[model samples]
Target: MTHTLNQPRNSTKSSSFRVDLQGLRALAVLLVMCYHIWFSKVSGGVDIFLMLSAFFLTSSTARRISRGERPPLITGWLHRFSRLIPQAAVVIVSVVVAAWIILPSTRWLELIDQSKASLFYQQNWYLANHQVDYYAFNTSSASPLQHFWSLSVQGQIFILWPVVLAFSVLIWKLFFSRFNFAWVAGAFFSAVFIGSLAFSINITANNQQVAYFHTGARLWEFALGSLLALALPWLSTLPEKIRRIAGWAGMITIVASGAVLDVQGQFPGFMALIPTMAAALIIAAPATRAWANPSGVLSLKPLVKLGDLSYGMYLWHWPMLVFYLEVSGNQKASFLAGTLLIAASIAASWCTTRFVEKPVIAWQNNLAFPHWMPSTGLKAISQIAVVAIGLGIASLSVTAWENNVEHRRALAASQTATDNPGATAPEDWDPAPAALTLPLATELADEWQTPGNPCAGSNNPDDERIMFCEQGGNFDGSPDLVMLGDSHMQHWSAAAAAAMEESGGSWILVFHPGCRYGSDADRDEAECANFQDAAEEYVADLAPKMVLTTASKTVAAPDEYLRSPGEQETIVDHYAEAIQPFLDAGSQVIAMRDTPRYTYSIPECVDSNPSHLEACDGSAHEALAQINPVQEFLAQHDYGQQVVSLDMTGLLCPEGVCKAVIGNVSTYLDDSHLSKTFVLSAKRQFAEAFKKATGWQ
Candidate 1:
């Protein structure tokens, strides 16, 4: 037992401890880098590392706490955080700077927004809400910081662990002070591991990628290591045979997890148990056992070297892989090239750790603060200072880019020849009178709810409408039921007609791309408002009972061009003001929420990997369980605006997560918008919900 403590790392000829563990790190990192680059698989290397991290940190922590020598939680957190934040900041700030310089104007503003979220460690949520699809690859715009989702999840674990450990030690001291510490830690690991497994399995099935990224469900892996550390005596006593096999077995599990798993395969589910348990076994295996000796394999020098660079390796690899894909256009590549990239990543990571992470980490540790200051307080101030500096730099770069970078690049008019016309997609089409996506049909339902645009005045009343015909007659058949709304209703046209026909009735549906019902753009647009005033007078005369609509969750939707603070606020307030007409009219507002949108579309998914479900996006129900800002907003509308849902709560989400697709069918036509086929399949489900809500069969 004392041998491990006695084994000081030599500059040359690394010990069993160093070689073996570092070797494990190398394997884990290699797997991850390869999977992300060429294998195109869900690499569980990060998961394995996370498990290892929990074990190592927890084990070390228990020893300190047990000796009644515990340091301040905040101090420890900042110490670890310091090791991480600087490099992360560099990557993030660098990405933002590079993006500002390299990306086109249409994406510049969005990149800036993503940078803000990345800095705050909310990239996972940013990606999940904006990019997750059950059957699709996350082909969203490259944010080097997207990899920080793991960092955020880990940071969350770090933030809460110390407090919990302190409490656990206290409780144990009071009741079973002399009782085996290992057992209590074991209990912690077992309970948490089980919970995580349960959660991972359940949520992966349902499509809640964000929740899966939540720290609560992932804490157990780290806790398992803590438990192992507390009970090191039990491990030290184990025979060589078991220890050797376990160590090797753990390595195999991590490799398998990284190389084989896909998006549909539940992670952190039963599948995660393999990597987590393997990690547990590695931590629990003693230095010199007979049968499954950790000494012979894990304690190698090259492995030890990699372990020293492990932190930087983890940070650097993902971004590099992404950058490679970005540069190469995520193409089909050779295994040999992938191997080289992984090697290059390892080399680059090592360099980064040595030059960047190590110096800052060492400096932070060596810094001498005022005698009166608490260590935690000094560390907190330093971290804030670091963050402030990064933010300042990023802000300055963005401002410079905004000034230097050209906007609109000599507009379409300038590009056109005398005979040719510069045009936008859907230029010839007019918005359906009651379509949701069309600006005129549904005045941006919630001004604060959308993104990209802030002014809610872009709808064209004179545009021709593109119809999907949800519940309507065939081309030769007479139009009976006319359904109208944005993409949500348009996608329903094909299915709605089928449902009506199945019911011995028919419908004629008209679809508008962005128009929503019972909403008006009149107040915000001078010309449109006048047009709307006259139209409202007429529409007041022609109300349609069978109405379909949508409200988006993009935050500041409907608002457009949003140039200044006054404009942003005015546009938001103005859109909020637009909801008055729907309340005033006795119009049945079936304000269907906008389907969840992924960061990218299917074409990219197909281009990236033709074989995987990444090519097939989900069912309408799978796309989401709940509505966007519309549902919540409708609850507070002036009048009792009767709003009915597609009953998407449980059916749309299972185990607390919603998917974009299930089985093989495509759920959305664009982003999170569903296709008519999906809407048709959902008829029975939506109908049941609708009937229950309105009591009309």
Candidate 2:
């Protein structure tokens, strides 16, 4: 992703302009644009860019070290970053301003965060931690800055590879003076290649989403390039006929790999070898006129010129595509629109390269400091420091704006708490008017509730599978109440905590995000199955006075018909079997009916359609089954004495419609999860329902 337009200062004539390599860069960028704009798939182009960066970097550093010349570790980084930062800064600032103007207000804070991450070269880690699926193909919801992830990885390696080379040089001079430095470096990189590739394969198999953005998983690709650079001299000795075959083969493979392979799912792993090694072959291939080679096609002037704009084009293309999708309201662009997007991206790239990148590079190269500044390295450092300060100012401004927005949202929530009665309001009650909906769109991300404290002492489950948390009352012994299940149960934690506090009893929360509490054999997901087994075992052994969980699962509207009688029986049978363990332990079961699931995010829908709130409403009859599954299960079984089914359908949906905004509070955070604000507003209702179900004072 980082384009090395200029060779290292120690470059030999052999390292001079290679039209084929430039053309390779152009092809890589073009493939990336084509796949992203039209195909919605990974092209493996960024992997080629990463490998080529290491190819160039290692080629330069190893040459210097071999000649007994000290590598400019400090000044080199300063120079490289100083050249790179100006264009990146311009793109980031432009994206931020554009996002504020064009994107929904709900996305502004997230954009600010990603912009900072991108500017500081930490975007890959940020996205990885968030578990963003790079191949989601949801352009409307995708971040315009997501493509910066690859660039961030490149930036990190640019810093790291140099230190690695410097250390290799030190070891070579001290311990392995008899051995060639390239041999030593190659040996070290070989170990990196093997170890990192193994790790990449393991992690990718376990979690492809995280592996895609993981730096350590990607280190092997760069190491392979380093190895190729070290072996170039030996490779050039091949016959011209063989080199031509390899060159054409590599070029053909690089172009065909994206179309044939599942790059998105399998990359940064062994599958990455296909394109990266193909690139390696091209890099090692001879480009003479004595024999036909891929260079005949790749060395064309227009393609070579496109390579000049590759870096800028990479930066411009994604944002243009994302914004185009947003403005046009299309899932995927038409071929004509995609072509125009590519053209606009190329033009923008040209402008940035011409007006921003070239000027900065020229200024840095021609820097003439005062006599007092003795070292050119110091002048380079000064330039880098100026860029750093500019980035710092921009980051601080964004942080201040984010803080102000959060403060205003918090103040508005507090002021309207009384007006927004939420689920506790009577069906016929008319609420007071408010300026903004409760849990404002800007604050929706924080709507998922948590217990705010992890379980401790005897209350904490020994099994790690149970994501245990504690709230309410003093933790002296076992919890008086236990809440178990997935996120559907998590949303009720606040209300449960309030009830426990009022009753002077402690409660433990045992949750796994998407896993329901039931028989492990019934679940298909291995992790969720394991979590369910552990949670059931932990809760049954602890034997709390009461256990709470979701009694049924709601499907999104349009597919919301009630289950068949046999399906209902099977569902309740699982619940009854799961609940029998708690009943045998002398714990009462409170099975609350699941909340309505919508086809779209409630908060987002409400945010975008505030004037026509009814458009965001859903059919209550369709949202919930005709008969409560829990009630049917109780009637069909003999557990009614201990198992109590609590249905809040009337509270959630009034007049046969499930309104997104109830009593001025945004009911659901996303499509299925209830907003914490709405849940907390329903605390009194929850407490009253608990009293009625248990006959507790």
Candidate 3:
């Protein structure tokens, strides 16, 4: 799938041109493109591609080994990557340039990081570490380079598979000379298949988001293909009628799997076998002249031609689709638009394959170096080095450009902050005219605050469910304040920290992304429920002087009216029960009302329509309820002045409107979380609120 149309050269008796397999490559790429553009569902095409890549790789390597020829591991790697990197580098460069011009500045840095990762074949791991959910279909903010994850996995396996085969050969020569190389290879891949499959199933069940890009979870698909390649000779000897049945059945399954199964949610696990095994059946089916042969349709001239362009097509389509969505501002493409995009991708791919892939491959095949360095291996290595240098230069160029943009933006933000008072700006104060928004869009991606220092020793909860971090705090002593709850509360830590530092106090931040501090029934996820339980216990035991958390959550438009008293009572009860432990421990609770949530990225919206800043402004009523649930909870409970609700909605959304930028500062990092710069701008307000709630000096 990564290097389609470049079947490895096989010198064995069983080695022959696999026209049918080439056509399968075409089908796989088409399925992937169509699914992404029209369906927004997984087609299991990527699984097929993984299997096919391993099948071809194992087939070529096994033949050489069985014939008593040493697998040309080093030369093979050099030649393979030399051919692959040039076209990939061209695409990466194109994407970086196009993304800069087309996508919002907010996405530019991430695109740069992903482009570099793609060049080095580490994109899968990068996505995995970032916890990107590939199944979450959001075309608006989808990365143009997301398709590279599969290519990265394939590229990684390309390096690992050869070494595995070489090791198998060395082992055979040393001890198991009596057994055939195929048997030894089969045993090794079988172990890989079982172990990886079990791991995939377990991880996908627990965290499909990470499992989707996990290399180990996907290795079993490659092993299944390797197993099929080893067993191909025996399979070819089956009766023609049986082979035909298996081949047709497999083809049908390949086409139908996406429609019939939950491929996106349950892939590279046991469910992935539907497509991988289907591809195997077709590969093992007898090649025949009969019209009934599945190969007849698969080996068609047009399909074979598409297979030749498949590698380039896979590289081209995603960025085109992403760019189209960005320019059109369409969530999904219409039929005609999708067709045009596909056609444009095909044209671009044709040009890349013709002008880029073919030339580099031919050059590699006929490469020559100075006579002083006459070794063929050295020549191969030189070709690889040339491609690597070119790719490195391109990546570094993008990095340098991004760094420059970031620096300029940082300077602009600093200058703007003096004039742009943000939330602290007076109701009638006129903001100074500025060229750039404070906390510029380029810097907005990193606006979500992270705890600067992790809680350690007795301060640390030692619980995986909750992330505990201490700031402006003496670790040896009990925290002066504890900040608890989800990211909604986490964003205000900047203000909390500033307030704490000013008062010569310390605070511990206890929160998990998307996890609200509430009753078990109120939490949807098991991890979040556990986090709530752990956080409650930790806060009670520590008994900090004050605990801060969001008391209410906002609902985004169109049904975003303020909740009624009855509705507020239920939410108030939930918070009262959750924070009762803190009250009993003589700790004051500061329950700030949650800030507004938006349906779309405020920064991106503002970036797109800088002139129409008012359009990005949201109704305050829609953002928050008129009645503060925490205030109601305080009135209901007999905790005296120990529990107090802080409402800063007036400061956040002045005059019943939540502006994207207040006095030049961007209001939010994305849609839900407030920018740290904006929060810090409201430092005076938070300090006053803290003094009122906790009676702190």
Give the per-residue lDDT digits (tens) of candidate 3, residues 417-465: 4576787777677765555776777777568886458777778887776
* lDDT tens per residue, model 2, 1-697: 1236322222222435466777788899999999999999988889999898898888877767767788767776876777677667778877876776677667777788898899989999999999999999774469999999998998899899989998888898899989988899999899999999999999999999999999999999999999998998899898877877887898899999889999878887899999998988888888653337777677777887788778888988999888889888799989999999999988997888788767766665567777787767667677677578658756765676678677767767577455777776666876655556788777777887885487767776877776556655765566778898888889889988888878877888888887777734337888888888888888889888889988786656342364532232224227777887899999999887877777677777787787888899987766677777778777877775588887777777877888888887888888888889898988888888888887655
lDDT value, candidate 3, whole model? 0.80
Q: What value does the lDDT take at residue 335 in candidate 2? A: 96
Cα-based lDDT for every prediction: 0.52, 0.80, 0.80
Q: Score every model by TM-score.
A: 0.58, 0.85, 0.85
Candidate 1, residue 192: how far the Cα is off, in Å: 3.0
True-structure lDDT of candidate 2: 0.80
Q: What local lDDT does model 1 show for residue 517?
A: 39
**What's the CA error at residue 308 for candidate 3, in Å?**
1.0
- Write the number of the candidate with greater TM-score, choosing between 1 and 3: 3
